[model samples]
Target: MAVHRTVEPSTSELGTFTRQNANTIHGHALACLVAADRYAHIEHEIKPSLHAGDTVICDRYLASTLVLQRLDGVPLEFLLDLNADILMPDLAVILTASPGLIAHRIAERGIRHRFHLDPTMPGREVDLYAETALTLTAKNVKVLVLDSSNATPSELAAEIADTLPDPR
Candidate 1:
């Protein structure tokens, strides 16, 4: 099994686009860049690994777009349409925690992106992720929602691993 992320190898053109300040780019434009990166990621990394009989675990996928892009003022339908041709995950795991806990963790870790500047974003993200879970489920993607508020990292990994089908 291998773990992959949407924007990888930060030096790549698409990865650079993802690192740009949100204020410098239009929301719709960023969404397009992200979708393009996803396609590139699938073709360059995910599909090849899967063909070799490897399980690829993506850190973020369509669900992230459904939530973050929507936060940037893009409509759901536009996002859905933009991402309509992307590869869908077999299992979409959504790890969540209480808004307060999430906020506290972010504070401790310091802000990484423009979204973290808004204090209300934490609560909004929690709500959006819950909604995203249902949306993914409706698309026939197996959705697993885990609360990370109280569990340790190891515990959460074990729980997620338990839900995976045996590769045998």
Candidate 2:
């Protein structure tokens, strides 16, 4: 299994774009553009993994853009249009937890991108993710909403693994 992130090195130009725009939507357009660019860059890896029969688990995929861009005031239609051709996951897992717990986890593990830095972002992210799950479900994508408030990482992985198709 290969794990891919939207920003590969985390210090690439796209990573810089995310960091510089962490607090507000002042740089929303540029960030969205960067996401589009990264999508193209990341596709090479995803395609090869699938061809080689690996289960590729993307840390953040198109669903993230739907939530984050909407938070920046971009309409859902626009975001959807931007990512219409990207490969969809077999099971889109929407992991959720209380905003307070999310904030605490960020504090403990360190913030990844600008979206997690805002003090008020957790609640909004939680709500938007939930909404996005519903929207994707409506569109017939397989979605699994799992609350991580009390589950350990191993337990969460086990639960997710159980959802995978049995090879036998």
Candidate 3:
């Protein structure tokens, strides 16, 4: 199994820029940077791993872009166009939780990004993710909406694994 990320390698210029400037960058520019990083990630990591017969699990992908960039005031159509050529996942698992639970978790972890600064962000993100799930489904992507409000991470992983088609 090979686990890839949208901003890959961690040391690449694109990844560094996206991470370091995420809070300060404008939405449109950030979206473009993220799209570029994704394409690079696919070429460098995801494709190679898949060709080697590894199961590539991406931590975040187009679904996340659709939600997060939209939260940054970028339009949905713009985001869709930005990410139009990316590799679609066979299974896009969207984990959701109640707003209260989400807020509590964010509070416990401390804020990592500008989005976490808003009091209403947790609710908005949950709602957006729900909407994103439907959008992905309409695009013919297999989506698994899991409620993580009460389940342990191990339990969630088990459920996700079970959802995968058997190899044999």
Candidate 4:
């Protein structure tokens, strides 16, 4: 699993702002690390293991950046150009749910950041994810959109597994 941190500014630095604040520092810090780690892992473990027909499953990939970064106000084209040289995914699984469900769930678990507290977050995230899935699908990558607000991780894994052909 990999998630690139995009423009993570301290919430305190926002000068006690409201959820409407979309201002961010769009740094490549975490993105750079993920990109590096991805390259290293692919070069070291994944590529070597491929016998021309094997499939690799990643919990998060470039699509994550496009969706999340766009929410942070970074342009989709910019994100893609940032990762232009990186390889594309063969399949993408996008999980979505009602904002109300997500909001209630997060309330139960408490909040994480400005993102979690943002009233616009749930809807924006859902839209970005759908947009990302559509974009990837148009590029010929298979995409499975899962409504995961109800599934446990184990159940989700099982469902995803059914979508892929077993190399075995």
Candidate 5:
């Protein structure tokens, strides 16, 4: 089982996030998310909040930058350029399921973010994530793409843990 990190952003950090909040300009954040600088900032400012050697299962990360920036008309190369030097995850997992299945899941969960506001955004996100997986794999990054159509989170986590290299 993975120990997930929950980094509570300090008031300053939260202010930074809110001040540069991507929602200000985009049709909605999903369409106009500017996550280019967030990856670097997190490592610089929030890394201390996490355990020294824990696996950080980031919810939406650099790939989110790539997708959202592209959606917002930023060039892929430009967006990737901004985040090229940021530390990559050790075991990146891309969960996949049918758009229908994902739609149902989101419908039940009720999101607080812009990404889930539009029903069509989920479909776009899935396609973008698939492309992102291919991009990541090409860079020699190890990625596990799992279909979460029926698997529970525990089962999925176990599958992922089994695939990860031993910490020792």
Candidate 6:
């Protein structure tokens, strides 16, 4: 199995643009396009590994794009159209926690970037993720949502591992 992470590419360049133009419709759309291009590049690079039977586990993929873009006011239909051809994950694990808990964790670990710059972002993100999960499920994608409030990391990992399909 391969663990691939979808990090925000061209952050310095695109991030500067995003920071300056936060909440602008066109700006947000441009950022989404940049992210799509990055995902495409990563998919091309890992084609061989996938062909050789590795189960790629991407940390964040299309789901994130959906949620973030929606939060930026992009219509869900538009987001779905944008990602029509992107590969879908076999299992999408959405880790959720109460906004208070998430805020606490961020306070302890520190904010990574401007995405969490707003003190209320955790709550908004949590709500959007829940909606995203429902939408993805409606579209027939298998999803597993785990509440992170009470579970330890090890416990969550064990549950996810157990949920994987049995190897033949």
Top candidate by lDDT: 3
Q: Write the per-residue lDDT of candidate 2 for residues 4-112, one digit (tens) a residue.
A: 3343223456555555655654445744664655575556666776777676676666677778778777788877777777677777888999999999999999977
Question: Residue 103 in candidate 5 has what lDDT?
Answer: 83
Every model's Cα RMSD, please? Answer: 2.1, 3.5, 2.0, 7.8, 4.1, 3.8
Q: Which scores greater on TM-score, model 5 or model 6?
A: 6
Candidate 6 colliding pairs: none
Off by over 4 Å in 1: 1-11
Model 6: runs farther than 4 Å from truth? Answer: 1-27, 166-168
Clashing pairs in 2: none
Tell me, by TM-score, which candidate is best: 3
Candidate 6: tens digits of C-alpha lDDT, residues 99-153: 9999999999997756667887899999999998998898788889999899999
13-92: candidate 3 lDDT, tens digit per residue: 87788879998996999999888988898888788877787677777788888899999999999999888888888889
TM match of model 3 to true structure: 0.92
Descending-lDDT candidate ranking: 3, 1, 2, 6, 4, 5
Candidate 5 C-alpha lDDT tens digits along 1-168: 345553312224543474356555563343223343355446554464344555555565666666665655666676666667766766678888888888888888877556667788768778888998888888778889899999999999999879986663
In model 5, which range of ten residues has the least summed lDDT? 6-15
lDDT of each: 0.83, 0.73, 0.85, 0.65, 0.65, 0.70
Clashing pairs in 5: none
Question: Against the true structure, what is each candidate's TM-score?
Answer: 0.91, 0.77, 0.92, 0.70, 0.73, 0.79
lDDT of 1 at 163: 92
Worst 10 residues of 3 by lDDT: 2-11
User: Can you write out model 4's per-residue Cα lDDT over 54-121, one digit (the tens) per residue?
Assistant: 56666567677777666656677767766767667656888889989988888999986557868889
* Candidate 1 lDDT over residue span 54-145, tens digit each: 77787778998899888898998999999888789888889999999999999999997888889999999999999999999999999999
**Which pairs of residues collide in candidate 4?**
none
Q: lDDT: which is higher, 1 or 3?
A: 3
